[model samples]
Target: MKYVVGLLLALACLQAQATEEQTVVLISIDGFRHDYIELHGAPNIAKIAEQGVRSEGLIPVYPSKTFPNHISIVTGQYPSNHGIVDNNFYDTERKQRYKMGDGVKDSTWLTTLPIWNLAEFQGVKAATFFWPESEARINGRTPSYYFNYSTPAPNRQRIDQIVEWLKLPEAARPRLVTGYFSIVDTMGHRFGPESHQVAKAVKHVDELIGELWQRIHDETEVPVNLILVSDHGMSQITAKDMIDVKELNIDEELFEIVNASTRLMIYPKEDVSADQIQQLEQRLKQKQGNFVIESEQQLAQLGVTDGPRKPAIVLGTTAPATFTTRPEEQRKDGGTHGFHSSRDMDGLFVAAGPAIQQGTQINRFSNIHIYPFMAKLLELELMTEIDGDAEVLTPIIR
Candidate 1:
């Protein structure tokens, strides 16, 4: 009788341990253009794509800057709902500047729950490698483990660290791991998406992906899954067309320039005028097509519209066009996003694993709807309405 009772207890413990080892790896290549995956140097990603399902382009959130879109991707919420609308904005509540790098204060401001929080609640260990806001602890603390944003480290080193984590015993193993790299986006902004430097960046990220794929298989078969996605895409802004806001008679008080490119954001001063706005547009010195300025209402209609953190007006550079407040000082690699995320600026996503069907393409996925799918992948409860529910992906699995 004693032996039977002991055996029963041992079996229960073993079952619990096995359940804890189910692993998922999610990687994000920032600013990875949708078209770039199949070209130049992304063969590994291509291999993954061939084996799984992918969206033609992963649409980004409004003001599709880094922080908001990233939180939305994982939490399944829009910037408005998720609390991060753009890179920099005037916080009405705090009535001050808000940037993603403000570690302590910003972390507390995240209202919606993230997948990491959900996974932890499920008794699953989740870890992240340099994901935006991942280091910020909410409720109590961050993921089981995480690294702050550090693009300076060699990409291969990040892969090595992930492999190291996999070596832990199943009971202690983290069930989910996320990684990120900025080289492709960095190169695109500097040399344009079509430039040779961008190609090199593509190759570098691809090689790292290949190394990770090889390492995971070579090390363990612990029922691991992989999801690759990007926050936004890059648009090249030529120097000859760069517009300097400083030269324009726009209300210095009516708005503050955040960042410029095909899309420029303008935060209105405390009090402004409509006729004054017209004058600024008329006197706006420069060649036309240099950049198009949009009123607050117009921006709201385009879906590029933002919320309280958003400015009253937005300036958008058309395709292949760019703008800046100070073109001379923005940096040689000076580039921009925050566009309407039209077909021209589509993002990227790929899922290759047991959780998804193989060799499938889902035509109708949107940037907002990816969260529900992730909820399905992690077996976690959904926190917000996934805008990406146009059609659930039916690939990457049997």
Candidate 2:
């Protein structure tokens, strides 16, 4: 009788330890600029900063687009390394085109393994609610539970779903969960970041965040780690600021404009002459002093290089000015990102849990570092090499 009782107590302690080691929730708020917490009085977000850890600012990877940065956060790799260099790009080598709205279901595009892969491989259940690349099976493995991305799911609905997932039995519950909210980015694009619409959107997100916080505290006895992150920041722009590249009337046969607007990347035709390339450069910069042409050496700063799919001549513009080939693609009063990383367009990062340091503030940190930080919290071993260094995030975590 004494031996049986001792065995029962040991089993209970082991189960409790497992539960504590496996509770991590990763939430992404699209376009969550670091200033929004103060600009909009984001109380719920502020709470995390006050009680847990908050970075002074979280710098995004270059190009600072949605999909790329989000994927980078989880994969611990740069967009160039992961192969999702832009929200939309034409793969010259594979003859494949990747567009954001259209389903990017193919996993071959990803060059590194994501956090979900590690979780699943270690027998830890993982779930995702609209995180980029969550729906696709990378290396024949997807999150244990993932929702298909569509038009933004209701914020309350997403929070409710997460709460339900947390309430499940330990064996079935997700040890690592990822979620997304696009309202801030949507409002930022429709109206400028300073507009009242953006404030309202920020408030809405704050409420949803509060709801999640309350639910987690109320429902879970297992120690939970909550991490809220954003892909990039937004910059105000206008239709009048857009430089019409088509006005140059350059021959489309000589090069294909792979991506444009804010940043322009062009792939030259195989047989294009050096003179033609120079002419194309002259035409692109004909009237724009805001354009800064990027060289192969400069592209390395953004973790990219010149390749068949990569633009031979990369053009970056100042805030409020952009390059676009489509005349109709204009916004009278809106916001945009994907500018140079030096523009100070940093995202937000807040974390709270047993592993996170309380009332700690990191002056600034890179988004790629979040991957190894998360892996450590969940006790999962990363199986692939990545760009992130675990040592950089040591200050933020216990």
Candidate 3:
């Protein structure tokens, strides 16, 4: 009888230990600049930084676009390695184009495993609330719980769902959760990053985050770690700074060109002769205005090595100027991103919870490092090769 009693007590202690295991919730605030917390007055985010860890800045991967940087953060690989080279690109192998906001169902484009997929594979249940590509069944698996990417979903509801998931029975709960909010990015693009609209959006998102932080602390016994990040920052630009591609006088039929606002990707037609391509490149170099043409070597430096999606020639602007295909596409006064090596492209990073050291400040680091850090926090094995070095962030871990 005494042995039976002892066994029951031991089992109860083990169950308690299981319930107390750390939970990590990664939140992405699209286009949340590193300075927004201070410049826009996000008291809640500031509070998190004070109580936990903050970075001088989070350096986004090259081109610094939304989809690529977000994938980089979770996959710990560059866009070239992960195969999401840009938000929109032509996949020559697939003979199809990838468009942003298209609800891509095919997982063939993703060459690397994201952290959520990794967690689910290793018996650690994961959940997501509108993370990019989270809806897709990658590797024949999806997060245990997830919502399709919907711009109209209320932020409050997303927070409520996260809380509910955390409150689930230990065996059923997700150890990792991802949430995304895009109001800041939208407002930044419509009205410049420094505009009143962006400030208001920042305040609104901060309030939601405050509510999330409070609920996690008060509603559950599980130790929850909250990590906040952004894909990239924004830069103000005007129509007067637009570079019209038509002005270059290139024959449109000879090449496939994608004008990505901040950069222009030029892919020569298969039948176009090498001499013709060289002549076109020469013409672009001579006519290049505020933008600079990027060479193969330069592209490789940006982690855009040779690939089918890799453009034959890239024209990258120096900011305050962007490439535009049509006159109507130019904005009078708004914001844009995707500039390589621009400080304005730096994003935000703030983390607070049981696994992170309190009141810590680290220098700028690339977003790729985040994947390994989160994997460590979740106590998952690093099962794949990645560009991020876990040691870069090990010092901030408690």
Per TM-score, the best of the predicted structures is 3
Ten-residue segment with the worst summed lDDT in candidate 3?
Answer: 13-22
- Select the stronger candidate by lDDT from 1 and 3: 3
Clashes in model 3: which pairs?
none
**Tens digits of per-residue lDDT for model 2, 37-108:** 889779989997788999878889878889889989999998888778888877778757777733346778
In candidate 3 the C-alpha lDDT for residue 312 amounts to: 77
lDDT of 3 by residue, 54-121 (tens): 99899999878999998999999999998888888776556577877443577878888899999998
**Where does candidate 1 stray beyond 4 Å?**
1-22, 103-105, 271-289, 295-307, 327-335, 384-391, 394-398
Better of 1 and 2 by TM-score: 2
Choose the strongest candidate by lDDT: 3
Question: Residue 383 error for model 1, in Å?
Answer: 3.5
Q: Rate the local accuracy (lDDT) of all candidates.
A: 0.71, 0.82, 0.88
Q: On a 0 to 100 scale, what is the lDDT of residue 142 in model 1? A: 81
Error (Å) of candidate 2 at residue 233 is 0.8
Q: Per-prediction TM-score, please?
A: 0.84, 0.91, 0.93
lDDT of 1: 0.71
Provide the clash count, candidate 2. Answer: 0
RMSD of candidate 2 to the truth, in angstroms, is: 5.0
